[model samples]
Target chain A: MSEFEPKIVAYCCDFCAFAAADLAGAMRLQYPPNVRIIRLPCTGKVDAIHLMKAFEQGADGVFVAGCLEGQCHYLEGNLRARKRVAYAKRLLAEVQIEPERIDMFNLSSAMGGRFAEIVKEMTQRIKEMGPANTDRRQQPVES
Target chain B: MIVADRKPLEEILDSIKDYKKIMLMGCGGCVTICFSGGVKAVELLASQIKIARKKQGKPIEIIECTPERQCEFEFIDAFKKDLESAEAVLSIACGVGVQTMSERHEDTITIPGQNTKFMGYPVEHALWEERCAGCGNCVLEWTGGICPIARCAKKLLNGPCGGSSNGVCEVDKDTDCVWQLIYDRLKKLNKLENLMVVRQPKDWRTSTDAGQRRVKFEEAML
Candidate 1:
């Protein structure tokens, strides 16, 4: 079997990225099978705690995908999501984790090909960075 | 409301680095409403600390609890049973709550997890701005509900100093001129003369620096 595939958690807005992922499958656009998608009503509902928990739970990489700016079904949800991602980035940096491990993207439901590209790109980036340091599973054995 | 913000995760982790058992106490009153020392914030901090400790191969036990209002003894008393198990207490409350916890639990070390900012109100979701000086005075009726002493950059009482331009203060172009706001509000209420009345100099001793501020109830006391 191939080496352990990096586990990526994708927080997708129910209106956009989630639909795009579904479309990608329908179109048979094959991407790495490392991504685990979590559907959120709006990107804004994805708080810093969720990102941190994803890391703590051993996610090698995480990304939040929301609707394009000013197109959120819940007005300003994407904007708020952007701010939360930025805040979480700062927090991850302070903990010695490369903030780039967590990212945010904006796309429409029709962007199936784009969603596939994102998954491939994030999977490669995480492979280069190695496993997440925040993973509790990798803790050193105590005497 | 007393505004505050959570301490950085690293700093919070460092505080309890030596303690094996820690109680992360949250306040459900002023700091809660501000989103700083609330139950959600306490849980977040606790989870982060646990993860950080586990990553370092250290074993730590964290207990999370929230007092109804840390400033009052009645609320803080609820944590007496939990505090018995922890060596240190992390208070996610305003300065008053931290002090109250410290006073009540002198044997156990207490750490503050929030930096008290001000007495303020929410301007928007997750955004708060200070509004009161707590100067032991109520001048809102005279100033048409705006506190020039706090909101005004210059603290001008009689009128907007000539430094005001286009309804904004000269001290900071972004800040609204308190005198201008007072003028507009008084104009709307048809109390223009209220602005012209000479105001007495405020008594500074009655404010926070004077001594402990107290509210006594005569018949209300049981």
Candidate 2:
């Protein structure tokens, strides 16, 4: 059997988490190559529905990296993100998915090492859990 | 608005476990306002169910649709084609909407996805309390705009039952005694006299106890 390579998705906020990822690369901070980073204007823009879609599209693990709780660039965006992430976790748990398969993190824009660390952490966690069941028998959603 | 809550995922999954494909229907009326059934809810639930089925290795297909008001036959009629195509329908509308679809489209099986909770509004961000019992009588005129039938723990009409402690109902510590609220409201409006009226036992016949109720408009009838 081939070794499993988990597919992890990180939703990073533009003002902080995304910048932190950029800095991680600039500073040559090595991280797992399995993560797919998608940047949004603010973590507040992330909704439970978006997280569901990420899993539906075959994500083995997902995390939202945002600004430190009290320091959202848009004031309370990270707080809203926190609530949505929590809600999404509950939804996932209800459906027999590991709630830990999803997570949220807070970091400063300058935390390049931390950004790399989160990616590696997520990759390691998902590897232990193996891949999420992507063998869906669902028909394509009619446009 | 009529507030509702979605049924747990496991029960919903079990009910439609036989179907290979289904239409996930949503209501754009009260359930939408309550954040239980709406376009967004439909999308979220569809993804959840799909993911669950995939994990079980018996995946199902879903088509999502939300009509303006599922209780109205006309709105449900518009989706007849899709309804006929799916093996079954999972409706997230309140009970009324689910019945309307089933009654009008007898050929399709429509399964309810929500429990109709109450006729109420959001007190705060996601908190809703039953406000009106639909008793077919308006007591708000004298009670200072509060209905004891719905808000009261014991549905008391006279005054605060001794069970209340610190203005909160002993039946539920999280809930404020509605009678206390009625008293405060009437006092602020200088209408505390309204509480003093000796009220007779309510006639329960006017409520749903009379059976399935209907309101007809003669002039509007074809």
Identify the candidate with maximal TM-score: 2
Which sections of candidate 1 miss by over 4 Å? A1-5, A13-30, A39-45, A66-80, A106-113, A136-143, B51-60, B153-156, B161-163
The Cα error of candidate 2 at residue B85, in Å, is: 1.1
The residue-by-residue lDDT of candidate 1 on B1-222, one tens digit each, is 889988887788888889999999999999889877788787667767766776686868889999889998899998799899999999899889889999988898889988888888998888998899887877899889999878876666789888889999888887889889999999999999997789877777778777899988989998
Among the numbered candidates, top lDDT falls to 2
lDDT (tens digit, per residue) of candidate 2 on B32-145: 998899999999999999999988989899989999999998888888887777998899999999999889878889999999999998889888878898998778998999
* Model 1 CA lDDT for position B135: 77
Candidate 2: stretches off by over 4 Å: A136-143
Share of real contacts kept by model 1?
0.27
Candidate 2 lDDT, tens digit per residue, A21-124?
99999999999988888999999999999999989888889999999988987999999988999999999998878999999999999999999999999999
Each prediction's DockQ against the real complex: 0.38, 0.73
Taking chain B only, the TM-score of every model is: 0.90, 0.97
